[model samples]
Target: MSKITSIATAVPVYQQSQMQIYDAVRAVHAGTEEEARVLRFMYKSSGIETRYAAVPDFNLENGRNEILHIDGADINTSGLEDRLKIYDKAALDLSIDVIRKCLHEYMNPSDITHLITVSCTGMQAPGLDLSIVKELKLCPNIYRTSVNFMGCYAAIHGLKHAHYIAEKEPDAKVLVVCVELCTLHFQKDRSIDNITSTVIFGDGAAAVLVENSGSKRAGWELKKFYSEINFEGIDDMAWKISKDGFLMTLTNKVPEILEKKCKDIMDHALQYYGITSEAVDSWCVHPGGKKILEAVERGSSVTREQLQESYAVLKEYGNMSSPTVLFVLEKILRRAEQNGSVKNIVGMAFGPGLTLETFHLANA
Candidate 1:
C-alpha cells in the first residue's frame, strides 16, 4: 500500500500575539474608556487566544477607519494584485523551507517526481510550483500541480492526488505543501463579520513528503478517503476577491451544521476499520475554531479531553487554513512516538463546499 513517509512545515517568522491584536484595536479607537476595556477582552471573546500575523506589527490601525479595522487584511487593499504578491512570496519561501527540511530528513530533492501545492489564501500561476523546482534544482521536467481556493480540506485533496500518483507508479515520491497567508486576506473594515473572521485565522504553512513503498521514513499508510457536503450551507463560508481584498463570510449558523452532520461523517469514516467512535485510537481533527470544536465535541461526544491538542493549536496559532490539520496530525504523531506505541491516526478537516474530509492513517 502507498504510505505517507514524512512531513515538514513552517510558519512565517513575523507574528502578532492576540493580546497585541486586541491592544491595537483599542488604541486605534480609544475614544472612550469603555471601548478600551472592550478591546482588552476582544481576544477572550474571540475564542482565539493567539494568532500569527505576517506583518510584525500588523498595524491594526491601518485597517480601521476610526477604530474598527478588522479582519487581518492589508491597510490599503486597493492594490489587490500588488498586496497579494509579496505575501504570496513570503508564504512560498516558508513553504520551500519546510519542503527542504522534509526532503533532507527523508529523501533528496532529486528523488521527487511529483509536486502538489494546496492553498486558499493566495493564488499565482507559475508560483511556488516553478520557484520550488528551480530553487531546489530538481528535475526541470518534474510534474507540478496546485490546488487553490479549496479552503481547509485542501490537504486532503493534495494527499488524494499523491495517492493517485503513487498507485499509478509505485516508485513515485511526492511533495505536497499547504500554505496560507491568512493575515493577507483580512478585510480592512469594521464590519462584525470581518472582525470575527480576523479573530479566527492566522498565517502558516506545512510541507509533507510521501514515497511509495520506499526504504525511508515509514508511517501513515494511505488507506481510504471519505468526503461529503452539507449542500444547504454552501454560502456559509466563502472567500471573494473584493476591492477591499478578500471578503470572508462566516455565519453564526455554522455550528448548527456541524452539530447536525459530524456524527454521520465520523461514523462513516471509521466503519472500514471495524471500529466505533469510542474504539478509535486517536483523533487528528481540524480545529476550525472555538465554537466549531465545541460543537463537534458535543455532536460526536468525543470528549473535551480528546480535543486538548486541537484547542492548544487554536490557542497558540489560531487557524492556519488547510495546514491546520497538519498541526493536529503532527501533535498526535509526536505523542505516539513518545509513548513508543503503534500509532493509528484518524485525520480529518472541514472547509468550504460546506464539507467534511477524513483520512485513515497508521505507522507503516
Candidate 2:
C-alpha cells in the first residue's frame, strides 16, 4: 500500500472577514431589511470567521472610500464566462505553488511516476494536470489521472487510485493535487441555501505525496479505503453548471441525515479490515460546516478532543471544497509528531452524492 509522505496547502491572498462578506451581500440585496437581518444572523452563527478569495474585489467596498459607495450592481452581475476566466488564470499558480512546497528539500520531482489532479470548481480542456507537469518538470512519460467533479471527497478518491498504483508497482510515486476556487461561484440570489453556501466556501489548494515504501521518511501508512452513498439524501446536496455559474443546492436537513447515517457507513467500512471503532485513535473529518461537524461528533464514538483539528481548519480557512479534508489530515499528521505517535487514524469526507468516503491510516 502507499504511505503519504507529506501534505501542503496554499490559500489565495485576499482574506475577507465574515462581517465584511455580510456587509457586501447586504449592499447587493439592499431595500430588504429582513433579508439583511437574516444574513447577519447567519454570518454570526457560521463557525467560519474568515475566508480567502482569489479575486480581491470579494467585498462590495474593496477599496477605501470616503462615503463607502460600493458598486453593488457590478459585483452581482458576474457571469459564467467571467468566473471561468478567473479560475483558469488563478488555478495554475496556486496548484503549482503547493506542489512545489510539498516536494521541496524532501523528494525529487523526477521520481514522481504518477500525477493525479482533482477539481470540481472549474473545468478546462487541456486541464491543470498538464500545466503542473510542464511547470514542475516531472517525468515526461509519467502516468496521469484526473478525478473531476467528485466534490470534497475527491482527495480520498485520489488516494484510492494512488493506493492501487502503489500496490501494483512498489516503486510508484504519486502526487495528488486538489485545488478549488469555490468563491468564484458566488450567487447574488437571496435564497437561504445560496446564503449558506456563500458564507462557507473559500479558495484553496492542497498537494499530497504518497509512495509505496515507508523508507527514509516518517508519515501515515495507507491501510485501506471505503465509500458509500445514502440514496435517501440524493437531493440534499448537489452541484450543476448553469448560465451564471455552478449552482449548489444544500439543504438544512443534511446534518441530521449525516448524523443518522454516519455510524452505519463507518461500521460497514471498518468491518472489512477487521477493525473496530475503538481501535481508531485519530479522527480527521471534513469540516463541511459547523453543524456538519457537530452532527458527526454527536453520532460517532470519537471524543470532541479528537475532532478539534477539523474545527480549527473550519474556523481558520472555511470550506475550500475538495482540498478541505487534506488540510485537516495535514493538521493531524503534525499533531501526532508533537505529542506521541498515534495509531489507527480514520479520515472521512462528504460530497454531493450525500456520499461518505473514508480511509484508514497508521504510523509505520
Candidate 3:
C-alpha cells in the first residue's frame, strides 16, 4: 500500500489580517456605503484571522502595490495576463520552497520516480511540473503528470494517482505538489460570489511524498478513495477563465448541498475499509470555509473537536484551494506523531462540479 511519508506546506511572504484583506477588497469592489458594510460583515464572519498573498498589493501598510493598483491608483482591472504573469513566478517559488521542506531529511530529489503537480489557479505549457523537475534536479526521465483546473479536490486526485503508481510499481517514490495562488484570481466585482471568494481564498503550496514501501517512521497508509459529483449543484461552484483573471462562482447553496450529502459520502468511503465513523480517530476535512466546515460537522458523525485541525488551518491560512486539505492532514499527522498514537484518518475535499472527494488512511 502506498503511504504518505512526509508533508510540508508554505505560503508567500506577504501576510495580511482578514480585516486588511477586507479593506483591500472594499477598496477595489465596494462602490457604496451599503456595499462596504456588507463586505465588512462577510469578512468579520469569515472565521479567518489571517491570510497570505504572493503579492504585496493586499498589504496596505507596506504601500508597494503593483498588480492591483497602478501609480497610487486602484486599477482593479488587472487582465488575466497580468495575473498569470505574477502566478508564473510566485507559484514556482512557493512550490520549490514547500518541496524542499517535504524532501529535507526524508529523501533525495534524485530518488523521486514520479512527479505530480496539482493546481487550478494557474496554467502554462512549460508548467509547474517541468519547472519543479528542473529546479530540484529530479530524474530527467521521471514520469510527470499535471492535474490542472480540478480546483480544491485536485490534490486528492494527485494522491490517488500516486497510490495507483505505487500499487503498480512497488519501488515507486512519488512526489505530489499542490500550489495555488487563489488571490491572483481575485475578482473586482460586487457580486456576492466574487465577494465571498475574495474573502476566503488565499495563497499557499503543499507537498507530500508517497512511497510504496512502509518505513520505520510513522506515516499514513493509503486505503481507499471515493468521489462523487453532484450535477445539480454544478453552477453553485465553478471556475472559469475570463478577460479579468479566472472567475469563481461560489454560492451559499454549496454548503447546503454538502450538508445534505456529506454523511452519505463519508459512510460510503468508510465502508470500504470495514469501519464506521465511530472508529475513525481523526477527520482531516478541507476547510473550504466556515460554513463548509460547519455543514460537514452537522452532516457527519464527527464533532467540532475532531475538526479542530481543519478549523485551525482555515483560521491561520484561510482557503488555499488545492493545498488546504493537505495542510489539515499535515496538522493531524504532526499531532499523532507527538502523541505517539496511531490514527484512523478520514479526509474530504470539495471543488467545482460540486464534486465530493473522500479518502481513508490509517497509521502504518
Candidate 4:
C-alpha cells in the first residue's frame, strides 16, 4: 500500500482576525439596516477567529467604516491581471517552502520520482510544477502531473494520481502540493454570495510526500478511495473565472444539501471497506465552514469529538480551499503520534460539481 509519509503547510504572512474582516465587510456594505444586521450575525457566527491572507489590505485601517485602500488606492478596482500578478509573485515561494518542509530529511530530492501539483485558485502556464522542479532541483526527468481547478477535492485527485503511479511503479516517491490564493479573488460586491465567499476563503498551501515502499514511517497508508456527486447541489457552489478575478457562487442551501448527501456517501465508503461508519477510529472531514462540519457530523453520525481537527483548522485558518484538508490530516497524524494509537481514518473533502470525495486510510 502507498503511504502518505509527511505533510507540511505554509500560509502568507498577512493574518487577519475574523472580527477585523467582519468590520471591513460591514463598512463596505453598510447600506440597509436589514443587510447590516444579517452580515453581523453571519460573520459573528462563522466559527473562525483568524485567517491568513496573501494581501495585507485586511490590516490597512483596522477595518473601520472605511474602504480598503492599498497605498491610497481602492482595492475594489483591482483587476484579474492584478490578482494574477500577486499570485505569480507569491504562489511559487509558498509552494517551495512547503515542499521543502514536507520532504526535508525524510527523502532525497533526487529520489523524488513524481511531482503532483494541485490548485484551483489560480492557473498559468509554465505551471507550479516546473518551478518546483527547478527550485528544489529534483530530477529533471521526474514525472509531473497537474490537478488544476478541481476546487477543494482536487487534493484527493492528486493523491489518487500518486496512488496509481506508486502502485504501478513500486519505487515511486510522489510529492503532492496544493496552493490556493483565495484572497486574491476577493470581490467588492455586496451580494450575499460574494460576502459569504470572501468572508470564509483565505490563502494557504500544503504539501504531502507519498511513497509505496511502506517504509517504517509514522503516517497513514492509502487503502481505498470513494467518491459520489449529488446533482441536486449543482447550483449550490461554483467558481468561475471573471474579468476581475474568479467569482464564487455560494448559496445558503449548501449546508442543507451536504447534510443530506454525506450520510449515503459515508455509508457507501464504509461498507465498501467491510466496515461501518462507527468502526472508523477518526474522521478528517473538510471543514468547508462551521455549518458544513455541523451538517457532516449530524448526517454521518460522527460525533463532534471526531471532528475536532476539522473545527480547529477552520477556526485557526478559515478555509484555504484545497489545502485545508491536508492541514486537518496533519493535525490527525500529530495526534496519533502523541497518543500512540493506530487509527482507521476516513478523510473526506467536498467541492464544486457538488463533488463528495472520501478516502479510507489505515495506520501503516
Name the candidate that leads on TM-score: 3
What C-alpha lDDT, on a 0 to 100 scale, does residue 67 get in candidate 2?
Answer: 15
Residues forming the 10-long window of minimal summed lDDT in candidate 1? 61-70
Model-by-model lDDT, in order? 0.75, 0.85, 0.89, 0.84
Please give the range of 10 consecutive residues that has the lowest summed lDDT in model 3.
66-75
Predicted structure 3: lDDT: 0.89
Best by lDDT: 3
RMSD of 2: 2.6
- Tell me which residue pairs clash in candidate 3: none
Compared with the true structure, model 2 gives a TM-score of: 0.95
The predicted structure with the larger TM-score, 1 or 2, is 2
Which parts of model 2 have CA positions greater than 4 angstroms off?
29-31, 64-75
Candidate 1 Cα misplacement greater than 4 A, ranges: 27-40, 59-78, 214-216
C-alpha TM-score for every candidate: 0.90, 0.95, 0.97, 0.94
- Pairs of residues at least 3 apart in sequence or in different chains that clash in candidate 2: none
Order of models, best lDDT first: 3, 2, 4, 1
